[model samples]
Target: MPQMMPINWIFSLFMFIMIFIMFNMLNYYISIIKMNNKMNNNNFLLKKNNWKW
Candidate 1:
C-alpha cells in the first residue's frame, strides 16, 4: 500500500491538471463562439437598418 501511494498521487495530480486545461479550453471556445454570434447579430441589424434608408 505504501508503494502505491506515490503512483496514486501522481495520477490524481495529472487528472486535475488535465481537467483544468480542458475547462479553460471550453471557456475559450465558448467565448469565441459568443463573439461570432454577436458579430453576426450586429451585421444583421445593420443590414436591416440600411434597408430602411
Candidate 2:
C-alpha cells in the first residue's frame, strides 16, 4: 500500500498540470477571438460611414 502512494501523487499532479494548461489555452484563444471580432466591427463601421458621405 505504501508503494502505491507515490504513484498516485504523481498522477494527480500530472492531471492538475494538464488541466491548468488547457484552461490557459482556452482563455488565450477566447481573447484572440474577441480581438478579431472587435477589428471586424471597426471595419464594418468604417465602411458604413464612408457610404453615408
Candidate 3:
C-alpha cells in the first residue's frame, strides 16, 4: 500500500500537468483562429471598398 501511494501521486501529478498544457494549447489555437477571422473580415471589407472606387 505504501509503494502504491507514491505511484498514484506521481500519476495524478503527471495527469494534471498534461491537462494544463492541453488547455494552454487549446486557448492559443482559439486566439489564433479569432485573429485570422478578423484579418479576413478586414481584407474583405477593404476589397469591397476598393471595388466601389
Off by over 4 Å in 2: 50-53
lDDT of 2: 0.97
- What pairs collide in candidate 1? none
| Candidate lDDT (C-alpha), each | 0.96, 0.97, 0.95
Among the numbered candidates, top TM-score falls to: 1
Q: Please identify which of the two predictions, 1 or 2, would achieve the higher TM-score against the true structure.
A: 1
lDDT of 2 by residue, 1-53 (tens): 99999999999999999999999999999999999999999999998887543
**How high a TM-score does candidate 3 get?**
0.79
List the candidate 1 regions with Cα displacement exceeding 4 Å: 51-53
Model 3 off-target regions past 4 Å?
50-53
Per-prediction CA RMSD (Å): 1.8, 1.9, 2.3
- Candidate 1: tens digits of C-alpha lDDT, residues 1-53: 79999999999999999999999999999999999999999999998887543
Candidate 3, residue 27: the lDDT equals 100
User: Which lDDT tens digits does candidate 3 get at residues 1-53?
Assistant: 68799899999999999999999999999999999999999999998887543
Q: State every prediction's TM-score relative to the real structure.
A: 0.86, 0.83, 0.79
